[model samples]
Target: MKKKVQILSILFLGISQVAFSQIKEEKLILDRKREPEVKKIEKKKTSVTAEKNYPPKEKKTQDSLNLKYNITDVPAASDFKTSTIQGEDISPKFNADYQNNYFQLGMGNFGKILADGNISTTLENQIEVGADLHFLSTNGLKKEYNWDSSQSSANIGAYLNAFGEKGKFNINADFGLNDYNYYGIYALTPAADIDLQQKTNRFKVNGYYDFYSNNILNDVRLKSSILTDKFDAKEAQAELLVNLSKHGVEIPMDEVTMNADLGINLETINSEFSLLNDNTSNYFNATLSPKLTFFKGKSYLMVGSGFSFLNGKNNSNLLTEEAKNNKTYWFPKAEVQIAAADEFKFYGGVDGGLKLNSYANLLEENPYLVSDQELRPTETKYKFYFGIRGDVDQSIKYDVSAGFAKMNDILFFKANSLFNNDFSLNRSPYNFANTFSAAYDNGTVSEVKGSIQYFPLANLVLDGELSFAKYNLDNNENIYNKPLVVASLGGKYSLLGKKLNLGAKAIFSTDKTTNSFSFTEAGTTPNVYLETEDKNDKIGGFADLNLSAEYKVHKNFSIFALGNNLLNTNYQTFKGYKVLGAQFLGGVKISF
Candidate 1:
């Protein structure tokens, strides 16, 4: 009897589970069917209505008037003049094919591997959705000395968009992971035994809503991200922005536009270091900007100002004391654009703002960074810039600009000290001197840059740009690892009936200098003092060239090859870091 009872209980549970699953599936289907009608894609056709008279007027035979006639002579066909008609010029159409889904995979030397794929589709009510995945990994390249330099990174993202008659909504989320080593020059090879590996994980979500109405609320945006690393370092940030605009306002000028924006940002950073213990920082800032734009026949002017308030607090043992600060700032927001001619325009502006720095951003700039950093925000006092942009013809376009700005709390990366005069290590982990520290200073910076794009043919494009900058610091002689000149040239061409494409790019940067220090013992035994001496090291200049070629094998398939660092200069971008030499990657791509 007990065995039978157990069998009956098992049967009953199985039946219940099946019924519940069916009910849940039905509910989901019903919910989908109940989507709002307003969200459905609507294409309205305009129609014109004709007015009709309620009653018809009676036909009346009125009085008839007298008539008069005149005769004209006709010309013979042989005497008439005839001329030839010119035909309109029509150019031949080129191949313009596109696909929404693709997958690519490639492998190269140095144990490199790359993979990428994207898929998208549109659903009912004009709802579009897509997902993207990417991955790249490489084993350590050949080095003079043995050091592990292997790295791998991957990311996946998804997006959803809904289009409506009144507004549009879009949301996307991404997750990424990176695993790499702090492969830099070290004084001793024994230090390599220490774990130099690091891993970072990040996730981000963004959303925006754009409205077509002429109301005050025109756009809304929200962004949030979280980042974490292997060494118990974490950072998270969230921001919200709303735009308000009123058009066709007649205030001091006809057809004026009034606009205002509100923004709020919040961030938190937590880092753990072996020597510095645990550090935590909290940041918050809010901003409001109001502006007015007046337009008059190809010329427009905008005048506005920005107000911001910041509040921050941090607790860290590395610093002498805990920090708590609150500050308010105001910045200018004004610009003017005047049309000098049909193909040329002159523009000028003065603007400035406060930008917050985060650990994630610093790491992206330089992967080898120490966690014990004094995080702060940089403030730009003001920047005045003027420039002209114009097109010489249908084939050439150019833009040139110059700007100067005074700034506070500008951050720079500097190498940490490696050892003492006796060649004794300073601290654990960072003793290798492979990691960089963040340093801040106040200074004024001026820059001039110009760029041009030329299209000599329908299927050929050429681009070039150059920039120069000068920095005058109040405390430091030079900004560490800042280049004075940067330039790039690139061109793309297509041939073989648009089936074959080729591209080439070249980049150059001037030498950058970084500060290094050496300590010497000045006193004896117990009273030993270490005097510090600063030395400037120059990172040599480098030029990198890259080339690529692709040929279509079919309507939906193509094969490609890429060559990077063709010069094989093996130049150091940083003081102690050396980049990889020449490499080649061949791959196939499929599109559907």
Candidate 2:
């Protein structure tokens, strides 16, 4: 087995060299040119102005010669990435500036053995490890409509990735494993409170181990995500992609050629949380997407469909974990998407997919914060929306698309302790979620791309949603959460030749409720939970503004600054939860 593995590895390495041989040759040519440039610079001499005072007695002008330093040209990083880490959530993330592209090679999941690119392979050997430390707080006053989540610690483990060659063959291995304990409580004040805690560990290993013989790519490579939780959330995905295109990946200007790939991905998620951890649920999702191109132009279309089978039985133990508490979803789905024109031009596609619960909650944390958690439910939805996409026209421009959706039970946090709740057999109706979104991107740099979204109605929202789906549960059937406005506004702008990045996001809505001026028979003071009918006030949404900038001051050094909650708007996206007023952070990085 060892011998075979070694042989196979060598084979793969060899093939990769052949595939990207063009790059090697280009490097050689570049080296030649680089040498000439250096020689030219060396031959150049620096001019100095005549200065008086070389000798106090002489007081005669003399030419002063200054030393000239040589500037060596370094190649740009191989790809468009900049940071590496313990897990997706752990930071020192890449500089917010999108233009700061330097590749750090490592391993885990994504393109290489490790999704995050860094070159330290020794530390990523076995049990992956990660760390996240964040501190946040606010003034003591717990005001209604205040949005806040206190200090927190989160991280993960397991990361691996390796690519390049295996003897005349191209092999890529990308995989990662992550585990984190997360807890945060945000209040919408007077009426709604969101206290959430989760412990999850996930693993995904994917890669296309290819061996190129006579330019034929072949091999058995697998991609998958494996998850294990404190409760009973288990998920696994496996995909196989076989490239059937003849060498060259493709020849430019030769539009009539098409390279085909046959791929099948199978996924499974299981849970047990009945009376005695007895609610057992299982689902299998399979998909096949293929790419087809026509004419020698820059256009391509990828089409595929996904099918799944799901079954679950809820018992008392199911309630122990909020996600396991609800057994809802369908197995199977239709998938469609098209990427045409070019890698940077027009593209459109859609797929009914599954998004993990943990992943979605991270986005829900703070309207302005970005999270990397992805362990929620097997997001099952019949999805279809298409539009043109590409950086062409200098912006991501796409046509409008609309589609119907059939959603099963979705999971969101409510004020309940999964550790002590009886969820094995009880759940609000299949959580209802309907969504529509549209936006416009300005074709100008340092300009903004804005979007507005809205949710018409909801079946169960305690007080209703505030920005970004901060739901208020009225009763227990209120167990489900809804998108605050189902609508919102957001945009991003690039500044300073793409060195500075700025983004603004906000969502708002209001509704009157029984919550009215119920005074202590005297109506002198207002109650925390007091409500007034027809008295409309913004229910949910946050107007979040975040700004970040990165400037390359030197070849190997860059400066960065991040400002969050820029306006420090006193409004709250979460009820009773008061957000930290304003935050400022500045840091510098040294990487070549």
Candidate 3:
């Protein structure tokens, strides 16, 4: 029993040892698994401490990001105050000064006088109102010259504007009185006592409405006007125009736009003299244009087309076959633009339209026109042009172009032929009347033109333009009154903070040809009669120079002097009428 007990104890001891070894192995495995967790805790604590010392970057505001230079070192302001930031003031500067009223008066050689006044102010409801008056008179160079003229005009206008909105309404009214004499006959009959006086009174009213929205009907406009003039002749015209447009029509890589215009015009004219005829005219026009623009690259092309319908009628005794009927036309519109570089661009286009000539319109362009005249519309079939226009530098710009145009029924002016009859009551060979009659010439005209503008200094600017034209008439008729070459140069300089301003302008024109009429005796002694003969008269070219200077005496007052025709040129814009010579005028301008 003692031997068995010893053996049992040994076995029990072996079993105990094996169990202890297994238990130890399990604990070792658990410790290996927990080692990574202890290292992670230590790393997390180190990360937290580092983050507390140095915070992460915060997102920047839009305003701060837009700044070109760094301003992170700037100190926070303790109190609100006006101060400079980087040599620029960050405060609002308000000026409550208003100067919208002015008056000027002056007199010069040849009994010339000028008076002008203007006043403008802002009213309630965002309304702006203004009025202006002007008066001018000149006794001319000499009594024998018969070039006396005088004019007076006034205008009143108002505008109602919606700020931060999309609408506007405006209206204006004008009245004018002009007086002049028929002095162009002096060259034909030097000693003729010509006392023909001409006077004209004009009245006009114009108004317009514009609105914009965000629908298919994006924009709309309505314009209307009434014009009337009375002289030896009476004329009246009324016009109305309506326009509608749409925008923001998106296409692939482009935007498309469309516009439509409808218009109506009516004119009536009458003459008191029995020689001139009376007439009434009406015109209706409508057009639709669609345009496309691409905005994907440096080069772009705009394609558009205009479909127009024109209807016209005239009730008169002297109406031409074309003018007395209705017509329809089509106009093409297109343009191309390419940006070659940062400061260089190339552009070109083709466009055409119809233009109406009325009695009131003719008189405004040439006041010496005869009352007995025929009116018509000019139709431009096509006008093609190509050019380059861009800035050479920050201080200079240039535009050069070449073009060709085809026109139908273009008008030219020529002196009236002398009547040759002794027994005829209206037969005065030298009637002491110089009348310009309109003549039509169907033709094509080609032209080249260029202009340049330079700013050598901030306060000084110089500009010039030159043009050349060639006309090919279908009927071989002379292109009367049209200059082949024309050029102009002008400059303005300001000194002493614009307290003193100086300006100079010069114009040059090439000679042109016109037809002149003269009377000659014909037949034998017993049967003596007068015959009219035609001669070509060459109007000489001329250069006109004008200068002006103004000095400010006060903030609201200025003294100025002007010199016109400084070269004393004996040039005649008309066939026989000579312009004024050298003259000086001084005046004071007051602003309030």
Candidate 4:
């Protein structure tokens, strides 16, 4: 039994040793495979985790600037122009800024109607058909020695406008035609003087307002334009206005602000005979001014001062042509107002237009320039003014003003021996009879203008106005003198659900002083040359009556009818200039 047990034990021991060796082998293999896989996993990690492992996120910030652009569309036709009495012909007209179609047949105040009434045809870029006609038979003046004349004239005009954008750029243009005429010059001229008449045909155009800025951006603005007046001259102008607000902030209310402006005006006259052989002037006007004003809450004040420079030439055609005058002028100005107290306030301002007319000739060194040294032109004026205003109600207001001024070296023409048979019938140098002097007698003038408004009812408005002016030569003779007075009263009524408006007006003016002297003066006579006076001018008075109505047919369409000198009363607003008689015009307007 001992022998058998010892053999079995030896066998069991051997088996146990083998089992232990196998277990150790399996563990070694497992460790070898797992270690390499774990190492690979640990080595291949994300950059995000690496960064997170290093530090917490740190906040970052920065300041930056930005730029932007803007554009717009507008034309030169949007401005106010001259007044009129009546028309002898019929034709639609445009704004004076784009074209001037004076009526030889006689057209009245086309500009005033465009501004106050509903007439889109007055804009250059419109399509319209209209008629303007007038006839006036003035009763011979009550005086024994009288000025009597009769006139019959008529006119017709039409226009068309095509619309388009300025492309990626902001630009626009307008084209149109106007015709007019005048008569009764037989009386305007006597056997003692030359008789003159005029017929006008005007073609017009204005294009491109290349660049501008948005309202809030007071930074940079560049503008360019070209204008031509057939009866006058051609002009090219460039203007730049820069607002300083871009460099800083904290704009205060009604406080002073600073800015800069640059303007360049170049003109080419039609002929040398039209002026003193020197009508075209090149102007470079620049200013750096501090403005103090605020219309907010009904109060405002503006004051500033800067230097001015003007250079004029005798002839503009020659490039090498030098200017005869290089004038430098400097002054300070102030404007003030008070309207915060609702109904009662005072507003007034004065600017000193101090300039030396013949400072130094710019073309003095250039031989190509045609200049007359004897004209001996010069000028200086002191302008002073004051005014008070009060608002009676939402639609009612009253204003009063006073002004006085004296001018030296005023411009006028002295009769040269060249004109003996100078008659209105002659066109050029022959019957034109004239030697022109740029310097005239010194003079003094005083003027007053004021108006009142009352809206007694919501649908009715009444207005009244008064004006007075007097002028006298400051020379040794003191024989040349002038005085003028004008008064007007009118009312307008709303009708047809306020879609239509009707108005009637009456006015009186001194004909002898107003119309009689409006002509160019030559050789101490009336209506011959510029800076001169016409012949045999006397004082007189005249009256006028006017009526008008406007109706709106749709949002973008309307019609208007107006009549002036409605009473057919004999009158004159300018001394030598013939007054238009009774006239009527009616037209339709379409707008976008």
How many times do residue backbones clash in model 4?
47
Off by over 4 Å in 2: 1-149, 154-161, 166-259, 272-280, 286-304, 309-314, 317-382, 389-400, 408-538, 550-559, 570-578, 588-592
Q: Candidate 1 vs candidate 2: which has greater lDDT? A: 1
Off by over 4 Å in 3: 1-99, 143-164, 190-193, 212-232, 248-250, 254-274, 278-280, 295-299, 318-323, 419-433, 522-535
The TM-scores of all predictions, comma-separated, are: 0.78, 0.45, 0.74, 0.52
Encode model 4's per-residue lDDT on 1-592: one tens digit a residue. 3343354345334533443343222321223211111100111011111112222121100000111000011111111111133222222222111112222122233222222111223234422222222232222221311222222222222222222232111222222222222222322233322332222222222222211221233334344444332233334445555543221122474543322222222222122223233355444445444443333334555565545555545543333665576766655566666664545677666665533232122111111111232232343445567777765444456677877766665543332322333335444221232212233677776879777765444445456678887667776343222336777665555545556765655666654421112223466665454423445455455555556665768755657676766545444333222444555656665544
Model 2, span 1-592: residue lDDT tens: 3353354345434533443433222221222211222111110011111113212221111100101111112111111111111111211232322322232222211121211222222243221222211221122223422222222222222233332233112223322223221212221111123322233454444444434231344345555665554444444545554543332244455444334444444545543331223434444444454433332333444444444333323333425553323333333332223444322333334555554333312333432211212233445365444333232221122233333333333444332212222212122111000010111111111111122121111100001112222222223222222332333333333334434433333223332111112112224543322222222223333344443445657656666554444445443332223444444555555553
Best by lDDT: 1
Q: Which stretches of candidate 1 lie over 4 Å from their true place?
A: 1-98, 191-194, 248-277, 419-429, 517-534
TM-score of predicted model 1? Answer: 0.78
lDDT of 3 by residue, 334-441 (tens): 777676853466778898777767666776556667665666677778889987765554455667788999998887777775433342323222243366876777
Top TM-score hit: 1
Q: How much does candidate 3 score in TM-score? A: 0.74
lDDT (0-100) at residue 42 of candidate 2? 13
Q: What TM-score number comes out for model 2?
A: 0.45
